[model samples]
Target: MIKHIVMWNVKGDTPEDKADGALRLKTAFEGLMGKIPGLLRMEVGVDISRVDYACDVVLYSEFDSHESLAAYAQHAEHLRVREELGHLRIARHQVDYPVTSLPVCAAAEAA
Candidate 1:
């Protein structure tokens, strides 16, 4: 499996604005599930821990292979979301890796 992870840090005019913007971003990220194929699963959401994290949103997804994840990342809709929110985001981080094995905690559950 291929794992894709992304994080975003965004700021708005006000706290309420920040909240609204974050939700919109989440919606935009989740929209990919319907538009993209080869997706086994995907998730997008705000960081509830409220710790000293730079990103306000987190996206985690699994695909059958690296190519599919790359395609999904390059999809026009995905690019649109990136372009649309590029200005609102203060910072962004992305990581992709092959899943050789699930963590022990997750592996147990999978069984």
Candidate 2:
């Protein structure tokens, strides 16, 4: 399985723009789930913290494989989401990787 993660920093040229942009980006992800077939799962939300690297939003998604993920990114439906985000995001960071096998340490986690 492949996991895709994305972090975003929203630059509110104005305070109002930041709030509105976060909502719009969240909306795009919710809407794309129905439109993108290869998307096995999707989750997105605000940072809600004061950490130094606290991005405005974090997106987590799973796909059957890298190729499927790639296709999803190129799909017209996703392109629409990007178009919407273009007006909202100041900067974005993303990473994709395979699930590494690890012991079930229930307490160890990072966000």
Candidate 3:
């Protein structure tokens, strides 16, 4: 499986505006669930840390493979969502990596 993670710093002048932007982002991304192929799982989170350097929103998703993740980037639904929320983000960060099996010790502990 492939993991795709993204963090965003939303744009807003006030606390209320920021919250609204975060909510909008959360709703928009979550709306994509089941709408795209190879999207095994999707999650969106709004930061509550209230830390000065924290990102306003984060997206955690799983894809079946790297191809799936690549396809998602150009998917029409994704493009539409991006266009709709493009202006709401001030900064964006992302990480994409393959999911590996748990270490032997960690797997044994789960049992």
Predicted structure with the largest TM-score when compared to the true one: 3
* TM-score of every candidate relative to the true structure: 0.85, 0.83, 0.94
Residue 85 displacement in candidate 1 (angstroms): 1.8
User: Quick one: ranking by TM-score, best first?
Assistant: 3, 1, 2
**Which of candidates 1 and 2 reaches a greater TM-score?**
1
Residue by residue across 1-111, what tens digits does model 3's lDDT show? 999999999999999999999999999999999998999999999999999999999999999999999999999999999999999999999999998897699999999
lDDT of model 3 at residue 55?
95
How many angstroms is residue 70 displaced in model 3 relative to the true structure, after the best TM-score fit?
0.4
Report the number of clashing residue pairs per model: 0, 0, 0
The digit string of per-residue lDDT tens for model 2 on 64-110 reads 78888999989998898888678677788999998656536743663
Clashing pairs in 1: none
Q: Which ten residues in a row have the lowest lDDT in candidate 3?
A: 97-106
